[model samples]
Target: MASPVTRRESRHFSFISLPIEIRDLIYANVWAPKLQLHVFFKNGRLVTAACLGAQTGDESTGTRVPSGEEMTLADNRPRGWASRDLVILRLHSTWGNHYRCEEDWNPMPGHISTERNACISLLLVNKTIYAESIRFLSQHLEITITDTDTALYLNDDAKPVIHDSPPPMIPRQLLRSIRSLNVTLFGSVDLFIALALARDYNATTPLEVVNQEFQQKVRATMDSNQERAVGLLPKARQWHQIWPGIAALPHLVRVNLWMNHSSFDSWSNINERAILEPLQRATWSPEVELVVYLPNIASDNIVPGEQFNNNDEDGLNFRVVRRVRCPDRVAEDSRVLFIVHDMSAREQEEMGDQGLSWDLGEMSIEMDRI
Candidate 1:
């Protein structure tokens, strides 16, 4: 019964003209393994980059960076595609010279192609395609909370001043869309030192003033236990501020909290229980899962590739040392998982030199579940 003109138009149908189910399959192929959404403040404006790798290289093209209007649209989309898979969060760029405390601290390096490709171009094909593709992307979007400073500022209620200015906070709508989050947990002393350095440093003040303040604090930490305890107070307060924001995430499925190895000694001093108290105390939905990666600070000798049971508290070769239940949860509910990786002193030094956090890939092979 079809007319000749209708038949001709059907014959010339484009990709978008296909059933949405077929188009979604094609989109999944293009976006398989998912893309990391790198959200950070650049020149005081909140910017995001979608890349295929752990970090977004300076050489990435503009297509990888979605426009502000596009981000707004993505945020306002209906919330049907909430992800249930494990989402790993990793930083997109390195923290540049924090010791300097300069206003323009993280300057982009000269472009050098990393060959990291992204399928974001598909979003620009057409409005209908954009809606479908973005929704698909949101289902598996992994967001990186670059540092503790940013994490503390995540809650809209939090208004802490850092580096003589209010630190950039993640947008609430964007936070809701995130399925995975990667956060770095700094050592108490290191975190406290950074906060002190940033808060005290002013462009108007002489450079010596900042240096003297830093040196004095370092000496106090070394000389008096009281000073060290005082310094650690901020770390606790910051974590308290951080937990509510994380618990408020409606669509979050997995969170990877990486404890910096350089601060292993300091963290060990504080005790893992105290450090993670805020997170453990916060009520989490049964669908949400948390993994804390810490350096094995136990005196026991742990050999790599050795599998130990979760209940084996006496074993030295255990990969997962503890699995504490979240408060107000049933006996059979999901618990917070803590993974400890044994790193030699030299290896710790190497990792610190490379970056603030170690990659989960390096620990995935040895990981065992309860």
Candidate 2:
């Protein structure tokens, strides 16, 4: 008689063998909910790293906004409320300082807490997993450009600021793969004073005197226009530098322009044209979406009349206006869609139950069809 053979039950599960839909759900659970990346130049090479800061309005963590001087640091810390579910990249200096450089991109230890670690190692498991992970990331990734140096670096025609041995180049494949981008047009608070001086100066008046008078006025009144000018004056000079690189991106599905100025009504026709005209001429595919988040201003500045009111029973917290190409003007340019969103509403939505309380407001913009 032969002894009964004992068989072992296999405990290992094949992740790749699962249906793709099931695999995707696992990927989503393992990966960061939203990956916040900052694009800038490092050692003459284009680098995209995780931004450092608490998620915006994350009161539970008790992280306060960085001071003005700290805001100027090269680490790309958030100036105000930070975005949520940001996955920190190991390449950032802050991350390198705290953790071993050899480690993979992971959420900062003390920052936002996470239940499970990001399974970035799955990319190394095999070729199929790598391709699938890349595909998943391309769809969820968001790149943010906040500095002029990065804008210049993105521009192919712009001269290299760094005289390093290797010529500056953003990886062509990476640029093509990016589906979403966030650009902040507000360079600095000082830009407001510059714009104000430029607007009030007369040829006969000495520049210094004009500047002094304006400073006094700002000190006395603390006018909203001064703060609003932050988004206006820099467009013509800086937008072109950034636009070329943005337009050249072949696969961009959405481009978000953050205009941090206070009131849309304060924008002059010239300034409006300076901003919108370039967008109208973008070389991207017709399906590309453009969303401009206007500054949060008083209700008085936003709702001029009843016509602009959206009449939402929810009390008009956010107003969304879509711009579509007119039927007759189809031949003039590609059929690009523009969505003007109120920043306050966006912030509230992002912050969830913890968002700042915003006063009700309505805003409108009139524009010629693209």
Candidate 3:
């Protein structure tokens, strides 16, 4: 049995080891539904998990302990109390261990999977890592991918292209098994469009037949577990349709839709309101908040002029920015909006608001549910 003194010391040393907020973030991230750990903390205790990550539907291999490439099988097996304990022992709040992340990787090419196996097998072998990962999972509920390369970067020689590998070969199920979501996308708006569409049309991803075929299997797993998340990237107007569906997901809270301003904004004209009007008219939930990040823009000149004066007596603060306009029929939560105009108020006044149309580039608006 764990003594109160030991628990206190462990909690204290851990609390001091990292910033309170950082520790809280890590704990929250680890607890999310997108990190593919088959074990988690339940009611202040560790519990076994069903084989939610087995996308290939091959549990037979999961039962057998392969010699060197044990990761494949271990990663697919039913995770139980034993697996939880293994993570705890391996991931206990040690700074050095956290840095090394030796528990996170293996000596061989397929060690990430082995790492999973080790956590589960270690529990089967003894009972250290199971306890450790669980504690770590509960403690680090959220973690950020500070690395520039991969969100969950584990470099290996055999780490073939994730897109090329079959679902059985890669940890695709690992995505749904995750308690938190961590992902990174590379390339332009086209890439973003593709990624978004993948999440939206995952049931029938247009790019490949495999993703479409596995849609039902993936959905079934999520509905059963009710503790998983999926994260991806997709850019373009075709993919934009995805956000509405994602908004309906009670399970999804964090998402990153990185985009580059379209040609519409810079190609001699602006039509911001034209784009948002349809979204406002169709469906936009009030329960979501958004962040508009301005990347790769040298000056706010591209943002355009304010067509409307929100400075009126209504005190309902608003800015009629160039091309980008507010939705005509905004949900109650959409009332509070921010216009990111880098130009000075004095310079803005000088423009004389001549022939300004609300039509601008794509207007990304965040909605908050009261």
Best by lDDT: 1
Q: Model 3, residue 112: displacement in angstroms?
A: 13
Tell me the spans in candidate 3 whose CA falls farther than 4 Å from its real position: 1-186, 189-238, 260-284, 296-300, 305-370
Best by TM-score: 1
TM for every model, in the order presented, reads: 0.48, 0.42, 0.26
Kindly report which residue pairs in candidate 1 clash with one another: 89-182
**lDDT (10s digit) by residue, model 2, range 53-94:** 212211111122223211212344534332211211211122
Ten-residue region with minimum lDDT total, candidate 1: 324-333
**RMSD of each candidate?**
17.8, 16.7, 22.4
Better of 1 and 3 by lDDT: 1
TM-score-better candidate, 1 vs 3: 1
Ranking of predictions according to lDDT: 1, 2, 3
Candidate 3 lDDT, 263-286, residue by residue in tens? 212211222222222223334334
lDDT (0 to 1) per candidate: 0.45, 0.43, 0.29
Ranking by TM-score: 1, 2, 3
Per-candidate clashes come to: 1, 1, 63
- lDDT, model 2: 0.43
